[model samples]
Target: MMTGGPEPDSPDVMSVLELLAVGAPPARFEELLRTARREEAPDSTLAELDQAVRLASRVQALIGHAQQREAGLAALVDTAHDLTLVHGMEALLHEIARRARRLLNFDMAYIGLRAADDEGRASSIRAAEGETTSLSVGLKTFEDSGLGSLVQRSGAPAWSPDYLADRDLPHSPDIDAVVRAEGLHAILAVPLGYGTTVFGTLYGADRKVRHFTPDEISLMRSLGRLAGVAIERARLLEATRAEVTELELDTSRARSSLNVQRRVEAAYIRLIDLVLSGCDPQTLAEAAVKELSGALVVRDCVGRTIVVTGTPPRLTEDDVLRWTYDAHAAGCPVPMPDGGWVAPVTAGGENLGAILLVPDEPLTDGFGVRLLQLTARAVALILLLQRTSTVAHDQIRDELLDELLSDIRTQPRQLIPRARRLGIAIDEPHVMVLARPEGGPEGRAAAWASSYAHRMSGLMRFRDGYVTLLVPSEDPLAAATAVSEELTPLVGHPVTVGAAGPVSGPGRVAQAHREALSCLEALTELGNLGCVATPQQMGFLGVLLSENRGVGEYIRSVIGPVVDYDTQRFTELTRTLDAYFASSSSPTRAASDLHVHPNTVSRRLERIAELLGADWQDPERALEIQLALRLHRTRRTLQHRHAATGAARDAGSPAPRGSGP
Candidate 1:
């Protein structure tokens, strides 16, 4: 051997150089060192060989550490990619645990999340992966010595190389029991979440005793950070998704409500148009039926059907009455027996009538019901307009009649033209009727008369607390009777109607009115309540009660046939009638007074029966005939006396009283 240094070509030196250059196993270099030592090499050579063996071991160890760092870096890159790809919190946490176990090369790995409200005071294992027993998952602890709490407090990684045997870190018995049961020897806990604020801990554990390298710890901490970011991303995505769902629901609801509002508005516009066009209740009901898809029945206040649209459900009068009452009480629509609704048509706090609706399908919401209510209001509006028109027309009629009957002198000049305009024929024959209610409401009789006059094409006037009418009728009795019959039930009491002449001309109205007033007064004086009568129907009292005081007409009405027969036949029937009355209806006595046979008197009586009715012998007829005969005889006697007086005056005057002779 050379003294200065081992020869460049030395076997041991060459073998070690070759092994270092080729990157061979340290075991091969060790085998060469042991063979040199056994062969008794020189001291210098042995020292050099020993140095070579030491150098080879350090270089190999450095190379192994570098390879481990490279592997950990590759795993970290993969873990970052996977953590970024994972979506939900739970799945991301599970993936993080799995990556942590594989990255750190641990027996098991898990993630522990702190209670949100505990502020790092408590934590529970949320996810686990690798060869973990069931005891590892869902493990929770509140102890300050637990690794999760330690990592949270320190805001850094906490590790135990041998959990059961380590004394450097605080220990919790509960956590220790889980460690023992799972046979976990080494455990490393790293903080997860943003810097300095750990919401949870990422854990890597092993069943075998092992010390954690800085690279492993660093890799695990990186993975925890990536997991924390991914978890937050997933939570935000979930929140965003929830917000979007809620917004979609709100949008849908708003759209539906808008659609309903549009429909309701359309219906309102159509109905308002109908109302403005002066449509009748029937037309309004038809529109409402179309809108509501139902049948409609409109009634009057008295429950008479004014109009019916669609096929309405049958309802009796009693049912309508009862439903109307209930609807009025409720001030809204009431359910009917046929699964329909009755809405009271009210205006100005008055129940005008009701609109009954029979729907084809039961209502699911207030939309249909609301339309029904709207229809009811529309119908009420139409009815109110019609009634207003009617009332106005009636007022006009009343005013015309009042002006006509007020001053008869000016009636033909001004009122006749106006009457013609109103379709009232004042020139035609019309009976004047005056009436008074016997124990009834004060104003109802006037209302009844107004309405009746309108219906009968007549004129009505309420003056001085009496209802007066001028109706076109030939029969005064019939007109008076009609007034009584119509006005009684309306006023809920008896009505006394007194009628007079069926006046033919305009100026005669006042005279007829006076005669009717006198007849009314007569009937009242005679206690004829609720009785209808004309002056002619009152018999002889009619002439006395009449304003014209028709005496000659009354006499003619009673015995005109007899007087005409005596004049036309040139007979003594008047003398025989006077004798008969003087003999107290004894024809034989009368015949004896006339110096004739009773048989001749009987023939004259038969002729009188033929001229007068067969009932001439009746008590009432006899009385009327007797009164007429007396009046007739008195008038004839006065005429004879006046004639004698005229002749006496002529005789008493000087025949030659003429100054000219």
Candidate 2:
């Protein structure tokens, strides 16, 4: 691209060339050809290009002077720094070499960094252009590579005027080829040193035979000295970097240790609190999630659990734990005796849940067995924390509901808005259900309870021991019944059941909660195992029966006359009617809840309508009856508990004998 320089024939150009040749070595003449350039130009442009070329050479000649070299050295030394270290050593060195070669006009150059051991050296063929991409310039070893060996073995600069002709060393096939093809008339190699250690070498090549001028040799020496100092600086910078790396590693370890220590301390405190409070596993779990998730920097930690032994309570859409049950049997991470950690979280060998700890780095030491063992212990503790937390959550739920039951019936209206304002969550048309384990550990039972509470209301262990939930969209009776069925597997024992009919309103939410609790308590046996109700499941009837303290007791008083009307008859009748009615919506499943053939349900419906003087053929009356049963069930549940369990329950419990919440 350059069109100026001394011309072959001009007097002024010859004169400058002559001065340049005064001490130029005959060994370097051909090498100059590789660096020199010529281009066609108009007469005036040629003149200007020649002037520019000569001017640059003149200026560069002065760079051999003391001051410029020093500045260059400082720049070279400073470049080995910063987050750039992320690139590792080889890439960093190559960048430096490439810049130096292009800047200094060296035909080719390389940096061979020596190692502490005599044979331990790592060097880069740092820069080469007019070369193939796959081409490599230096041999890897200290012994085979000339620049590497010279930098390590020689105490001073080494010159190879005729590289192939140099009898003192051996050459590889690639180097031999480079010597012949490059017309490499000579090479001047210099050792870059730090104190007594030869850290690396710097070299320049000549493509033709010519003598090196005094200034040329001086420039080479100057460049070499700068490179030597720069290499030493780079090494010191690198060494300090290594030290910083060690410090950072230590700091990271300390930080992680602090975090783990904090978690352990928190766990211990929780265990103590659980014991003192006599809270079951569900309660403990709820408390742990509230405390631990807040204390640590974990996201959505508690719900990603799978309960194998105990049936879990109803979960809403957002409860991740509901999905985890699908995961445990698929990919287990807990370790087995076969020497890998792959076992999942299980309570008493029953897969209760799987715990996940997502760390910025893999939780691996990548070191000795002792560190690995410590890692295992840490993981074990984490799993223990998750499992214990689940149990604690469930136990707290019933106790929580029991505590708040009184408030629900008193203020039946403040439900939805209260829930939203308190950061308590609710899904509309939601139903609430209650259950307690028959003969399981209080902790596990409670954990299941809290889990469902969270699932049903999207509320997790809020305030004292309460769990609010959001139920899915389905018929209220069907959904509540399904929830009860879903819970049996989680609690791992026979459980009672109660459910609220679907209704919307802040005030009415309390009514729903009470309904659920009452149903569960009153129907503790198989008579109401699958969302069925004895007279206990129905609303208050006579004045005498209605005057009773509890619906179950009231139901018992009226049920003596209907003793022969056992759970079976009720189950069959309800099943038939549900099937016949829901058949319009393809309610075969609803019929299943009633335990009857779909066709038989049709006939039962006709007979019932005939007896009640209502027309089964009339959709309106049929729907009314269904709604009434649902409401009856809902009312039964509410009579036993306060309606204010929903968010709006803040005012106070309503007086007794007010129409059911």
TM-score of each: 0.48, 0.28
Query: For model 1, which pairs clash?
Result: none
> Would you list the C-alpha lDDT of every candidate in the order shown?
0.75, 0.45
What TM-score does candidate 1 reach?
0.48
lDDT of 1 by residue, 1-661 (tens): 2132222334477767767776776667766776777777798988888887788788888788869866766666566555555657788888888788777778898888877677657888889887546777777877477777678876779888888898767778778888888888989998886322467889899889888887677667767766665665455445434634554465467776655545655685688678758788887788878878878888765456879888886677667777887887798888886789989876545556788888999866666876676677667656644553343344457656656565535326666776888888887889999998877544445545655676678898765567889999999999888878766655557888899978876777878888899888888888987888888988788877777757788888888988999899898787888888889989989999999899888888888899898999899888888888887887776677666666657788643332222
Candidate 2's TM-score reads: 0.28
Runs of candidate 2 with Cα error greater than 4 angstroms are: 1-352, 355-418, 421-427, 455-457, 460-474, 525-661
Error (Å) of candidate 1 at residue 546 is 2.6
RMSD for all candidates, in order, please: 50.9, 33.7
How far off is model 1, as Cα RMSD?
Answer: 50.9
Question: Per-residue lDDT for 629 in model 1?
Answer: 84
Q: Model 1 — which ten-residue stretch has the worst lDDT?
A: 1-10
lDDT of 2: 0.45
